[model samples]
Every structure is written in C-alpha cells, then in structure tokens.
Target: MPVARSTKAQSIKQPRAGKAPSVTENVPPEKEEGCQAKRSPSSPQGGPKKRSAFGDITNAHKNQAVTGKKEGVKAPTRKATRPPPALVVAKNNEINLKKSLRKTPPTDVPVEPEKDSVSEEPVQQVPVVEDIDKEQLGDPYASAEYAKEIFDYMREREEKFLLPDYMEKQPDISRDMRAILVDWMVEVQENFELNHETLYLAVKLVDHYLVEVVSMRDKLQLIGSTAVLIASKFEERCPPCVDDFLYICDDAYKREELIAMETSILRTLNFDINIPIPYRFLRRFAKCARASMETLTLARFLCEMTLQEYDYARERPSKLAASSLLLALTMKNLGGWTPTLEYYSGYCAQDLHPLVKRLNFLLTYQPCDKLKAVRTKYSHRVFFEVAKTTPMDMMKLEEKLKS
Candidate 1:
C-alpha cells in the first residue's frame, strides 16, 4: 500500500540543522504534483502562499487521528423560546374544542325550515313633496309683470276693505262708543282664545258693515259677536262654536240672531272677508327692522290701540302699521326711521312724521277709562307690559322726525 500525504506535508521545506526533520517521507507523489500544478506562475519563487479550501478541515481531522481522540464537530443547538401568550391560549383553545367535539354526542334534533326569501307582493315607496324655496321665487328689484300684477292685486284687494266714510256714516255710534265696543270685543277675543288676525278681521267687518248698513247702538254687540264668529272661522284653525261665542257674550244674543247677523254681514261685504289688516303689515315691517320682541310688542300695542280710534280707519292699513312700528322704534330709542324703512314702507320720514305724531299722541294720551280692555290686557307681563312704558320725549322725537 502506498502512503498518502496531505497538501500541508507536500508544501513543507526540508528541516534545517538542529531542527526536527520535516515529515515528508510519507507524502504521495500525486498530491505533490497536484499542489505544484495549482501554484500561480507569477509566484514560482514562492512569495506569499494562498490557502486551499479543505486545508484547515484536513489538518484538524489529521491531528485528531494522530492524537487518537475524536474531535467531533458539535451541531449548533437552538435556544428554546416560549411562544406568545395569545398563541399559547389559541392552541389550548383548539385542543379543548377538539376534545369537546369528540366528547359530545350528536342528537337527532329537528332543524327549522328556512323561510322563503322572495315575497309575493312588491314594496311600495312613498312619494316625497319638495318645498319651494322663497328666496328663489323671483328677483325682488326686477319689475316683472307678474310682480306688478301681484302688487296690484294686493293693493286692489286692500282698497276694497277701506271705509272712506266710516266716521261720517256712524252718527249714532260715537267714536267712544265704537271704542268701547272694540275694547269689549278684545276681551271677548282673548276669552275665546282667538288669533289676533281674527280680532282685526272682526273689526274690519264691523267698520265695513257700518259703511253700508245702519247698525243701532243696541244691536252693536250682536254685530260684533257675529263678525268675530265669521272671522274666527276664516282665520282660526279650529274656530269657536256658536255656543262658545254665545257663552262669551253671556248669552246676550241667541244662536239664530248670531247666525242671521253673520249672514247679513257676509252679504254686505260680498263674502270678501280676506281683508288686509294692520297686524300683517306690522309684522312685515317689524321683521324688516329686526325689532326685538319688546319693540314689536310695543308696536303691536300701538297698532291695537289705533283700532279704538275711528279716524285711523281712513288711513291705509299698511301705512298705519308702518307708522305704528316706526313710532315704536323711535319711542324705544332704537334707530330712527332709516331709508330701509322708507323703502319697505314706501313712506319717507317726512311723510311718516305726521302719522308717527298721531300714533304717539294716541299712545301718550290713551283714554284708559274707556279703553280699559286693551290697556289692561297689554299691561300684564305676558305682553311685556309695553303699554305702561313711557313714550320717548315728544320734542326729541319730533326733532328726530324733522331731521
């Protein structure tokens, strides 16, 4: 058998003097030839040596074999790590579930039949009604024919309710008597819980009916009651019954008499009960002024007070309402009547000065003795007691109005 030698043995030089001899005696000729062939041509004089791939492994194994001890290369061991708490719990749950499923026996319980998914009838959807936005109605400044037509219709209708001769026609019914009647009607209106519109309409009906028909002082209550009943029916959502009105009147007029007077009044007016009243115009003007509730209440008090005066019937309802509101704003030390007021009211400060003075005089010098109902009604806290509020100094107000 031939001796085999490693490449390490083939690369060793001969031993020098006094050094142990190199172990090249058992080196194989083939390994020596292989190592010599692998040497670089530029390094034939042997400068720095290059390493072989299996040099250290072969050397370690050869050393172990010569020392008669096995140097077994240990396989690397991995550190035992614990799984996350959630994963551990999940694995336990899976095991428990498997055990439970295996332990439980399946019973022959009857299952419910599935419901039919399709229905025989179709579902109906409701139709929605969209509201018309008032802002998009039309241009306010544009003089469209329809806008003029609307204004003309409103003005013409308003004119129809005007009682040009209301004062002259009622000779027997003095202005004080008329005021007393209206004051009593205000009480009746409140007692009946009627709308303010109903009261204004009732007063209009009384004035209009007096223009054409002769109403004795004795039948005035009957006429007022009938007018209120008709106005209530027209203005209120649920009008008072005949018995309600009769009861408020303390049974002063019988049912048949009430009905007959209502019919006569309706016929005299030709069923034109849709009269424009100061209340509507007052609200519109107050909104334009952005008056507070107290200011508006004061204006409303002034307007309602005007109802007791027969002279105010001659003035246009819209103009009277505007004047009343302007007086109220001035009396409260709020802003004077500005151009915005003029534009909305169609009256300059000079034009409204007279009407404002008239309203102020009426407010300052109210005959509470005769007009107790309206004054007392407004003096309460509910109406903000604006009736009791002092009017602005007349001189200052006059100067302001003049300016």
Candidate 2:
C-alpha cells in the first residue's frame, strides 16, 4: 500500500473484443457484500418440499423433514411412499403412449405419390395347370413286371399315346461288336466325367440308328463319336466340341468325318431331340422313397458307373434308376422300404424279381477294383462308401452274374 508501485502499469495491455469489464478493477471489495445481499433469495434451503413438476414429492425431502422434527416426536412415522394418483396416471399414460408409438408407423415415412397421368395397367393372369389324376391314368408301369400283362398294356398304350408315323429300328451290330463298342464308349464316358444318361442315350442311339440305317465300316467310330457328341450336347451344359470328340478317339476319325456322322445321326433321329433318360426316373424314384439328396446323388454315381457296363446299359431306364436308388439307400444304411414307395414305384415282390435280381447282383458283385483304382488316383469321393459293401458278398454276386 506504501507504494503498490504500478503493479501492471508498464504493460499497457488492450482489452479483448466483447469482454466484460474486469470485476476486480471496476468494483471495489467494499461493494461485494452489497451485491450478494441484493441477489439473495427470500428463503434459503431451496424451495418448500412439495410435488415436483411431474407431481411427485422427492423421497429425499420427505426423509429430511422426518429426521429434523422434534426429538420426542416419535420420528414422524413415514406413510406408505406411494406416488400421487395424478403422477401414477400420468406415468401409466406415458407407458401406454410409448407402446402405441411403437405400434404406429412413423409420420415422416416416404410414400410413393400417385401419378395422375399414368393409366392403370391391366394384369394378365396365367392359367394354372391341373394335376393329373393317377386313378384315371391307371398304372403307367402296369406292363413293367408281369411280362404278358405289360406286353398287352404297352401295346394298347403305345397305340393310344405314341405317334403312328414312328419308324421302327433295331441295333444291327453283332453281339460281340456291340459289346466291344459299349465297353469302349463306357471308357470314353468315364474319361469325360459325363452323365450316365448321355452314355446310355449314345448307346441307344448307336443301337437304334444302326438298326435303321446302313452306315459305312469306316464311319462306325464316327457313329460312336457323333452319338457321344450329340448326347453330350443334350445332357451337358458345357458339351465338348467335335474336335474334343476327335481327340477322345485319339484323332482316329477326322474332324470333318465326326461332324458329318453327327449330322447324319441328327437327321436319322428326325431332330426329335427328346430322349427318355434314366436320371429322371432315378429322381422320381428317389422322391418316392423320401431318400435324401446325398443318397440320391451317390446312387446316381453308382447308376452312372453301371452305364459303362454293356450289359447294364441295355436294361430298361426305370429298372436302372430304381435299382440305383434302392442300392444307394441300402449302402447309406437307410433300411425299410415303405409300401407307398413300393406301390408308387410298382416294386412289389411280384413285380421286382428281375430288377431286384439285377440290383442284388450289382450290389453283391461288379469288380469295381479298377474303378477304385481310378477313384483313388483322382482321390474321388464317389468311392467313399464303396466299403459299405463287402468283398465276400461281391464275389458271390460275381458268381451269380456268371450264372
């Protein structure tokens, strides 16, 4: 105080923009109490304890009043601390409102505006297909098992359903030549990783076309190649080219020769591209059995394996498909064939003798050791369940196929 010698005098600092005047310099210490007294509330310990804005007394205020009463006043026994009626109703209303809000859609959600200029378009409905009544259809396979009955039934059915102008054809190759052709074709089909239907149809085509048309000896391999090419085209989404067919034949047949043979076969068949393949039969039979897809696929692989065999390829497609599916179910340890399956498939004991015999023989025999070798070479999973059969049983089947 003697000489509070210019404490901040030397530094002539400018005040900042929009700054309030410093309280320390503008108001003296003597004026501080006067400002506080003027600002003081009429009552001190906050407002009186009553209902809150939402109409509920705070518990803390209630507790303090009870504790602060006269010492002997029996601690002002607390009443049941229920919320006021108004507050309870308000809370219930809030809950109900929240629930309704959840149920109601948002008001600001975007809606498509109707176009006044556009006319309403009429919808064209498609006609639904009616289910074919099985009772009216009788048995499609009535002739399948009982030879005489099926023969007569098929004759009538053929006359009723088949085209009258259909040409008759049969396989012309000698048994041994046909067998050799079948074996070669089987090998080629397996090499290509092709569907059994393709090979089966190819074999059928070779047999059918040879029966009807007189082809050159030089064109025999070409016939096989062309049949395979056409069958592949029908069966495979990504069919091999004509050059690929030539390559499969080790270039024994020229590319032009294969193409010419393919054209001839296509013409001979009258471009009636529909071939009744075994896979469809297999699927239908599998469905009837309620066999799983994996079982069906494995059975299909087995069926395809049979397509390579000359004897097996000659069997009816239905028999082939049924036997494959049945054997697959057996291999997978899925036992118990249902009556529905039997009735639907027409695979009763009386009907299934030939098919069962073939299937039993196939399941029991068939020297798949070579197939195992190929499967192992490629590490293919097709033979994953091959051991589901036995060598001793397989030998027995071998002996039976011979018989």
Question: Top model by TM-score, which number?
Answer: 1
Number of the predicted model whose lDDT against the real structure is largest: 1
Question: Which pairs clash inside model 2?
Answer: 143-150, 170-211
Clashes of 1: 0
Off by over 4 Å in 1: 1-152
- Candidate 1 residues 44-111, lDDT tens each? 22212222322432344334333321111121232113212223333443464456445544321001
Position 30, candidate 2: lDDT: 52
Global CA lDDT of candidate 2, please?
0.53
